[model samples]
Target: MPRYEYRCRSCGDTFELSRPMSESAAPAECPAGHADTVKLLSTVAVGGSSSAPAPSSGGGCCGGGCCG
Candidate 1:
């Protein structure tokens, strides 16, 4: 099962549900009992050990330091 996120339009509430992928697009009820809800695009992050190289501190065109 995968977790899906949703937001209620009627009450402006957000919630998550775990269900089968087949029903991933099914409608869900909000915690506040609102039926007018919409599924949200979720993001998944993949990370590794701290030993991995860190991102550039100044990622701008010439590195933020050069511009500054």
Candidate 2:
């Protein structure tokens, strides 16, 4: 099952649900039984710094910031 993020407009509650990918969204009813709700796009993110040597700068480095 995949996780879907949801926000309750009625109670202003944010939550996550684990359901089948086909579920599409969770019930509008909030945990508190509020009917006004909406499914939200989760903003999951990953953070890391790659030290594997930066790729060569396009156009090659020159005395000016913009060089070709």
Give all candidate RMSDs, comma-separated. 8.8, 7.9
Q: What is the C-alpha lDDT of each candidate?
A: 0.84, 0.71
lDDT of 1 at 22: 97
Which 10-residue span in candidate 2 carries the lowest summed lDDT?
A: 42-51
Tens-place lDDT per residue, model 1, 4-68, is 99999998988999999999988899998889999988765233346656667778547767764
Instruction: Kindly report which residue stretches of model 1 are placed more than 4 angstroms away from their true locations once superposed.
Output: 45-68
Error of 1 at 51 (Å): 17
lDDT, residue 32, candidate 1: 86
Considering every candidate listed, which one attains the maximal lDDT? Answer: 1
User: Candidate 2's error at 30, in angstroms?
Assistant: 1.1
